[model samples]
Each structure stands twice: as C-alpha cells, then as structure tokens.
Target chain A: MAQQHLEPTDPTAGAPPKLSTAVEQGGPPTGDALAGYLRAQATEFLRALRLHRETGTASSVEESVDAARALRRSARRISGSLHTFRPLLDADWSEEMRPELAWLSGTLGLEHACEARLDRLLLALHRLSGSTPFPAQSLTSDSAGSGPPAPVTPERGNLTVGAAKAGALLERQLTLARTRAHSTALQALGSSRFHAVADKVAVLASEVPLTPAAPTTDLRALAAAAEDRLLAAAAALPLVTAGHPYNAEALVHGLSPDPAPHPQDGPWHQVRLLLRLHRYAREVLYGGGAPVDVRLLAAGQALNRHRDASEAAAAAASAARTPRIAPATAYALGVLHADQRHEVEAARFAFQQAWQKQTVGTP
Target chain B: MAQQHLEPTDPTAGAPPKLSTAVEQGGPPTGDALAGYLRAQATEFLRALRLHRETGTASSVEESVDAARALRRSARRISGSLHTFRPLLDADWSEEMRPELAWLSGTLGLEHACEARLDRLLLALHRLSGSTPFPAQSLTSDSAGSGPPAPVTPERGNLTVGAAKAGALLERQLTLARTRAHSTALQALGSSRFHAVADKVAVLASEVPLTPAAPTTDLRALAAAAEDRLLAAAAALPLVTAGHPYNAEALVHGLSPDPAPHPQDGPWHQVRLLLRLHRYAREVLYGGGAPVDVRLLAAGQALNRHRDASEAAAAAASAARTPRIAPATAYALGVLHADQRHEVEAARFAFQQAWQKQTVGTP
Candidate 1:
C-alpha cells in the first residue's frame, strides 16, 4: 500500500548514481558491453522524458523543465557510463548515437537553443537606455552608438524577432530548417508519447518475461517493459490534443491498453496506470513498490531547494551595486525579503495563487 | 505447391461482395497477414531487364529528382482521396488505409525538397561561372576586377549555397530513417501480422462492398500457422547484434531479414545460421534465383540508366557550345564523359583478366 501511493521506480533514487556508480562499477570492461549499455540507457532516457512531456499533465513550464532536466541528468549518467564502455568497443560509438539522437534531440536542442538565444537577445535589447524603453531606442542611433533600445527591457526576449530583424533571409534559412525540424519532432514526442510509453511499460510488466531470469528479469526485460508501457500510453492519447504518436520509430513496440488504473492520478492518467502496473509486477518479482514511481518524491523536495536558491540569489543581488534587475527577478527578490521572520504570513492568498499558477505548472 | 505459394486469402483480389466472408471469419488481423499482402511484385513490364550495380545503392541527384516527380503524382492522388476519406469518416466509417498511405506519401515529399535544392544549387552555381570553356580574357579581367572588397561580387550570397550540398545529407538521412522505420514495419507485417490481420480484413472485406470472397479457415489455426511462420522468419535475424543487443522491435515483426526467404524461422537460431537460412529460404521462395542477384540486376539497370544519361549529356555537349553552368556540373559532365563503358566485344576479355586476377591474386 505504501508503494501504491508513490512513484514506483523512484527515478530520483537513481540520481545518475552520483558519479560514484561509475567509480564503483569501475571496470575496464569489454568495449562492446559498455558502449551497448550506454547507448541503450541514453536512448531510453530521451524516450522516457519525451514520454513524460507528451502526457501534458504538468500545468507549468517549470514542471516541464524539471521533468526534462531529470531525464537529461539520467541520460548524462548513462552517457558517463559510456566513458567506460567506449574504450571497450572496436569502433567509436559516439558518432552512432549522435546521428541517431541528433535526428530527435537536435530538434529538441533547437527549441532549447531558440529559447536561450531569444532570452539573451531580449536581455541585450531590453537593458535601460541610460534610462528609456524599447522601440523608442530599438531603432539604431543611425550614428556612432545606439543607446539601449528600451528604457526598461522586458525580462525575457520578445518572440517578434522575425527573419528580417535577425539578418538577411538567407542567414535564417538553415537555422529555420534546423529549428523547425527539431521543434516538430520534440513537440510530437512530448504531446502524446508519454502516454504511449507508459501504456507499453504496463503491458510488459503484466506479461511474464520470456528469458530465463536470475533476478526475475534482466535489463532487457525492464527496457522492453518500459518501452511497451510508453508506446501503449502514447497510443491511447487523443491525437486531437498534443503529444507523440502511437507509431514513431523510437517507441516501436505494439501498444496494448492496461486493464488497470494508474497510480498517483496525476495529470497523466495513462502514465499513472502503466507505472502502477509495472511497479506491481516488479514488486511481485523483486519485492519493491508495486507501480514504482522511482524516486519522484525526491523532486517534491525541489521546493525546498528553490528556497535556498532564492536566498542565494538575494544575497548576491544585495551585495551588487546595481540592485535593480529585470522585473521578474525584482519580484522574486521582493518575495524573499518578505519571507524574513515569517513576515510573509499575510500572503496566504498570494501563496495559493503562486502554487496554482506557478509551482504546479513548474517543478 | 499452390498453397505454399499463394497466401490463402489473396489480398490483391479486392474486397469481397457482401458480409459473407466476415460472418464466416472472425477476429483481428495478425502481423503475419499484414506482411503477406504488401510485398512488392515484379511484373513483365518491370522485369524486362534487371540491371544491377556493384556498389552503393542510394539514388543519385537526378534519379531523386525523378522520384520527386512520381511523389508529386502520388501526392495528388492521395489529396484527391482525402475528400473521399474525410466524408466517410464523418459517416462514422474508418477510412484506414487511405490516410496511412497519404502520410506515407507526404513523408516521401520531404525527400524531394532535398533533391530539388541539390539540383538547383548545382545549376545556379554553374551559371555563376561563365560558360564552361573559359575565355582567357574574361578570366584575367574578372581576377583583376576586385575594385571594392565588399560589393559587386562578394561571396556573401554564396554562403547559403551549401544548402545544396546538405540536400544529399537530407536525402540520405530520410532514406535511412524511413527505410528502417516504415519499410521495415510494412514488411514486418508478414504471415503472422497478416494472418492476424487477414482475419480482420476477411471480416472487413466481407462487410465492405465489391470484394472477393476470403477462403475459409479457422482463424486460430491459421493464426497459429502464421505465428509459426512469423517466429521462423524472426528467428532468422540476429536479434542481438554485438552493438544493438536488446531491440526486439524489428525482429519481433520479421522486418530485419529479406522477406522472400522462408520468413517462418522463429527466434531460435544463432544469428549467423539464421542469415544463411534466410538466403536458402529466399532461393526457395523464388525458384532457384537469389534475391541478392535480383537486387543486383535492378541496380545494374539503374547504373545503365545513369550511363545512358551521361551519354546523352556528352552527345549534347559535343553538338552545342559550352554551357554556362556551375563548376560542379562541368566537373560532373566531365565525370559522365569518363564513364568507362564495358562494351560487349571486349567484355569477354575483361572478364577473363578479372577471373585470372582473382585466381592468381594479380595486381
């Protein structure tokens, strides 16, 4: 029952194994095994996170980003393990994953890139012009130096920077191609894929593994089960909405819907169900949580970490001569200042609003 | 012998007239059934000559352009049918194959863009360079005409020209991906997929108007037979390549191996033995002839077509003044001219020399 309420796998429990896992596994193992393992895990991580996003249960960008970061961290750990695996292989394995993953990740990276660049561009353009606002100053001085475009820049970059504003149409062509391809692929994976994979994992967990197993089932079985659940979940997702499809190459397993309900009952019902199913099966086999959440509760602690981050940022800002930053940060700092001596007690309504609008939406 | 050759329910026979077949038949289609119907056939029109190439099988720049033309034709057919599917869907009837075919055709289009761009880039760049044979006077004048560093003839416009070069990369990527994903998926729906599907189709076809009657059989028995064949074929593939150890997705459906072979081999054989078994199966599938040789013959035809294309270009070049073209095209034209043709008269001698070299290990 304790397992029934939580994420089964407790993904946070993995924690990239803290670099120590690599140190501990500590082997100049054969190249074949290492490379294969690394490739498999990294690919799996991307697939899993892509699935998470497609579920669309998260209400905010922060939650989405948190999920992405968790997946990325797992992938990195998997990649780190590859360091050991690479030396074992007869041929370079990096190129193999790069081309394949790039086909998918390159597109996701493009979105990230656009977000980063747009943010930077906004930052550059938005700084106070000796003291005036945008468009008033966005126009070039047409002479020696152009004053800052806007008196007070917006906290983030504007989406209005079309190809003309960026540069010649020619310059933007390749970037557009690269970005569109990535964005399309990423969006597809996220919108419906999460449900698909969850569905798939659930199926495999319910079924008995074919191979002779010492630990009940092997890594292959685990992966196959996960893939099964994910694909099934993706398949069940309503296409009229968003997310990955039932038949994309990455999650190629046949989708079969779960006969049971998901655990947690979060935004993603399919994911909840499949995860629950897998957890149950895994527990039956290995005595772990039924429908394991895999360390997701660790993420619940992120709110605490965010508090620390806020304090650190406030201290740094207080020390700086230019205490004023963007309005967003200013607002954030204001909240931090009010937190002193529990001085923010009167803001219960505000806290509720923030939790509903921001925290729930984010991590 | 006929039973061995003919899939009991001939897919090409069209939907049977009335609901008789489905009432007699029962259940959904299997993977085996789906594959049996989709295998491409060779007819006398296509079989007149099966020319094969010795090396890489990728389509060239020109051939890819032609494929675009066919794709456009197919695209038109699909879009025209969309109205047919859309209206039917509104009527609560699923127009399954048409939509899927449409998507397949649409993805084929992305390949065309790559081809056209490659061709255009090559064309434009050639035009930028004067007519192929140089007028020595203009060459000198052009070299001396760099009056200003930035304008008139700057290479800025040419930077994006690399887009043409990237076209091949795009095409190659598409071919590799789509081929691995859909082609394999389609082919994987073999006797097992099809037999499963055949039951469904038999029912559906019987319900749908204007189709032939499905042959009678117990679906379970047929499905079991299909599974036997499916496993047999899937077993022939190397499920765990040294690098890709756990992906059963491709093998599970019998997509990895040549379909012409005895695709009934299950997952029991060692990868090496399975490969040999597939070859033997193919020979059995096609009386005494190897698919390897058939593919080779087809390639030779493509190469001959290319050779013919080059010959045509050379003849045109000989008849006309040097063309204004990209230096690349001029280079390509030169290459076309240099195509070493193996004439019928000396081919005998060349073969003897090659045979001798192989036997004696000559340089």
Candidate 2:
C-alpha cells in the first residue's frame, strides 16, 4: 500500500465546545477535530516505528537504544490518545489497534531494559572491583538480625574477591540475557505481526475511521470521566490507605480473598500507568496553555522511584541467589541486594511523605 | 541492657517432637533450637548492617553499593526466617523487628537505586550524544500506528542536538534526586528509629523470647503451610491464566469489576515477593540438600524482566516530560521513552511465553 502522511496539526487546535453540545442539531465538528489530533499522533507513531525497524539491525548499542526509545514513546502516545479519543473513533478499529500497539511497544521495551540492565550491572562490577578501602565498619554498624557484626579489615584483597565473583556471575548472566533479548527484538521486528501493524498504521496516517455521530461526542465529559477513572483507581490503592507501609504483603493481605492479590494487589504499579494516561489526556487538551497537575506529576515521579528501587532490589536478589557461586561473590551480591532494598524503602518513604503532605484532592 | 550472644547451635539439632508432646513433662528443646537459628540470622544481619554503616560515608559509589547490598540480603534472611519460625518465637518481638528490618533494608535499597539510575541515564546520554551513523532507519521500518515513515539522513547534528538536551535534563534531575536520597539514607542511619532497632538487635544477640508453649510448635506443619500460602498466592497471579499479557491495564480491565482489579492487578510485582519468601523457606528447611526448583527460579527471573522493563519505561516517560527543556531534548526524551516502553512490551511477551511453556503446577 502506498504510504500517506497526515499534516502535523496541533492536537489542541480545535476550539473548546461553546456549550454542552447535547442541544446542538448535530453537535460541532469535534469528531473531525479529534480525528485530526489522532491522525497526527498516528503519523508520529508510524514515523518512530519506522525508525525502530530501520535501526533494529544495527550492531551499535547506542543506535538501537535511541531507536527503540522513539518507537516506544510513539506507541504510548498512540495508545493513550486512542483510549482518550475512543468516543469519536470507530469502536472496532480502536479496540484492534490498542492491543497491537501494545504488542509492538512491549517488544521494544524488553530489549531496552536488557541493554540498560547489562550496562548497570557491569558498571557496578567495575566500581566494586576497583581498588578502594573496603568500608569494614559498614557491615557492623548497619547489621540487623544477624550475629554480632563481623570485623571489617581495611584489606582490598579480601573484599574484592567476593565482589568480583558476584560481578562476574551477573555479567555472564545479564550478557546472555541481553543477547537473547536483542535477537528476540530483531525477530519480532521481522515477523508478520509487526509488519501487519505497520501496514495498518501507514493507512491510519492518512485515513482514520470516524463514527458518523462522533461530532456530537462530548470531549469535556469524556476527559472528566477519564480523569475520574484514574483518580478513582489511584484512590483505591493501598498507598492511599492510613497505616499502610506501601509493601507488597500489606497490600495483598489488605484485600478480601478471591481476587484479593492479583488485581487489587497492584494498585501501586497500576496507578503509574493510569497516571501516564491521565497526564497525556491533559496534555492533549491543555496543550501549552495550562500547567500540568503538580500532584499528578509528583505522584507519578514518586511511584516511578518506587518501581525502580523495588525492581533493582529484585534483580540484586536474583543475582545473590545464583547457585554455586564463590563465597566471596555471594557476599558481594548480598551487599548489593541489601543496598537495592534500602532504595526501595527510601522510595516508599518518599511516596509516603508526598502522599501525607499533599491535600487529598485531584491535581 | 548488656548485649549477650546466643550459641549458634544447629537449628534442627532438637529432634522433631518424640510424641504429640502434649503430655510431655516439659516441652522438648525445640524453642532453643529455633532461637539458635534466629540468632544466627540476626547475627548475620547485624554483621552486614555494620558493614553498611562503616561504608555509608564512603565517597566511592562502588563501596556504598556493595555494603548496602550485603545489609539488604542479611535483612531479608532475618525477616524471612522470622516469619517462617514466628510460631516458635515471641510474636510481639518478631512483629516489631520485621518492620524495622524492612525500614533499614529499604533505606539502603533507595540509595542504590538512585545511584544506579543516575549512572544509567547519564551513560545513556553520553552514548546517545556520541557521533555515529545514528542508525537513522530504525523508525521507518518499525513504524506501526502512524503515517509514512520519516526519512533519516546520516546527519549526526540533528539527532545529537535533541539527544544531548534530553540527556542533560535526565542528568540534572537524577543527580539531584540521588543526592537527596543519599542524605536521607544518612539521616535515617543516625535517626533514633534506626538506632533503636540496632540496640534491640544488639540485645537480641544474647537473649530471645520463647512462648511457654513453643516447645511443641510443629515446624514441619508451619513450613508446609507457608509453602501452601505461597503457592496459593502464586496461583492467584494472572500469569497462571493462559493468554494473559503482562500489562497492568489488561490485567486490571480483565476483572469483571465485581472483585475489581486489586487481586489480579499485581501478579508480576506481588508474585516476586511471595516467591522470595518461598525460596527462603526452602533454603532454611533444606539447607544445602535439595536443589532449587528450576521452574520457580525461571518464573522469578522472567517476572524480574517484566518489572525492570516496565519500570524503565516509566522512568523514560518521566524523563520525556522534563519541564522547560529545549525542543531537541524533548525529542530525544521521546525516543528514549519509546525505547523503554518497547522493552517493557518485550519483557511481558517473554513472560507470557515462559508461563505458557511451563507445566501448570506450583514451580
């Protein structure tokens, strides 16, 4: 199919409805306006997806990371905009496109994570293995439920042995994983599933399906509902509860049996995504004129920290559990895991602090 | 109170109850054995904690990361063992120590994550800004939901300008956050909350509370129940269901809304914690005898990927929204966000594949 281009029209260009359009003969031309915005996003998404495919084969890490990042951002925008503007678009088309976009972006996201992790673990190893006075007093002072603190000698040789082993174990495993992820990403890019999405997007760049009755769609109401849905979800999180420690166990046990831990258990994680969508919807509507909600932004940022810290801790724990590693390496990894866990606590603390400080209301 | 040391006796040295023990003159010596094990873990935790304290003031990132990791691992072991053997120990004591251990580990976890993130975003900037062919065709071929792919020229100037801006924004914000976290951690270490726990642990090194009825505590039953609880929790995960993608939205929306999304919302995140507890239980019971469950291990690893990818995507998105940055930087951040989100997608895909391939049973 011949690829067509949509003009990069401003998404917020259409004037706000003069009144509740329910009384209008057929409502204002908001459907076309929404479609115009959707098309612009679709166009940008296709452009970035194309960039990803082109650079997917590159051997250079930098090239792949950049390209993948572009593709992911575009996919999110398209998906978020589709959901936000779904009322004005063909229901079938929106449903079909959302999952496919999700699939494509997810593929790229994994590859990027592998690359970043490899980078992080390796750098940690380098720093760890470097000659520095091993802080002998650290373990003793910070020791918790163990026996009395072991004496730390100011010897680099003793400390480096364990740290190096841990580093080596992590490097081997992460490198292997990164290679696998890189290959998977390449294969997915070449797959028919990907190609099919590309074809659809290329078509969407020019032609967007609009319901005949869409002009009458109340965007303000839709926006309000979306915001309300997000707020409702966020409010429902265990983090919003009094006396909660923002840990997994507390959240899980807090639920009533049945579906207790699966769906409701993830309020902290789920809220971030909702916040993303919420922020995007506001951006689409408010454009440059309105200031973004500080609370929403802060909550998202704090949650982002929470997620990052927790994931890092998990990763560190995984490394520490590597079977049959040298004792020294095991020791090093133990330290790494504890450090990452501390970060998780800090992030949670930060989130709690923010939540407590903020007035309970919409941003 | 003067600190005392519990003898590190074999936890299993005390025989399993010779009889139902209800009629025994005095309960068997099981409480002492259990306390012995608890003391061992406590000692290890304190040792690591000391190492962390000693190294906390180190300017070397590597030293701090390593020390923090050790503190975290020891804390986890202590926390896990405490829960596993809570029936044999003082309930109030165990309850109090678990949260405090959690706090200490959490503090270190946050510090490590901030340091890691700052390192990652800065490195990404450096690479993105470096001169290369730019792998310009990436988006064109991968373009999915938009219009015709934009052409990429090999020109380095256009891409680098925007990338550098994005990189700068991330560097500045992440550095600030890292600095703040470091200070917070330091403050926490010196706070009464931390010192109080330390003093308690120091005292516990020598003495432990045993419930009067503890001698007859059935450990084997406790282990079985703990395992069952973990299995039940794991089974509750949406991943256990066939054809579930690992996205937060799908999982949330999958629920019919009666039970809501709380239970199903957190499989990818919540399951990891349960798995950690289960693994620890096994390690405690089996020691070096039984091999780790390969399926459980693999699931844990896959879930780790899902988490890392998703978190990275969120971080990227946050970066993309950097306020008052140059347009070029914003463009770069857009690419980075897209890339991270794609990684998230890829990890979820990998997880679904793994879950499907595994036999339907507790790993």
Using lDDT as the measure, the top candidate is: 2
Which CAPRI level is candidate 1? incorrect
Give per-residue CA lDDT, model 1, range A68-165, as digits (tens).
55554443434333222233222343334333332343444445444443333223223211112234223332112122343322212211111112
The lDDT of model 1 is 0.28
Off by over 4 Å in 2: A1-29, A53-61, A118-159, A240-265, A287-290, A355-363, B1-363
Q: Give lDDT tens digits, candidate 1, residues B69-90.
A: 4433433332332222232222
Best by DockQ: 2
- Candidates in order have lDDT scores of 0.28, 0.53
Shift of residue A309 alpha carbon in model 2, Å: 2.2
TM-scores for all predictions: 0.21, 0.41
DockQ of each: 0.00, 0.01
Model 1, position A230, has a per-residue lDDT of 42
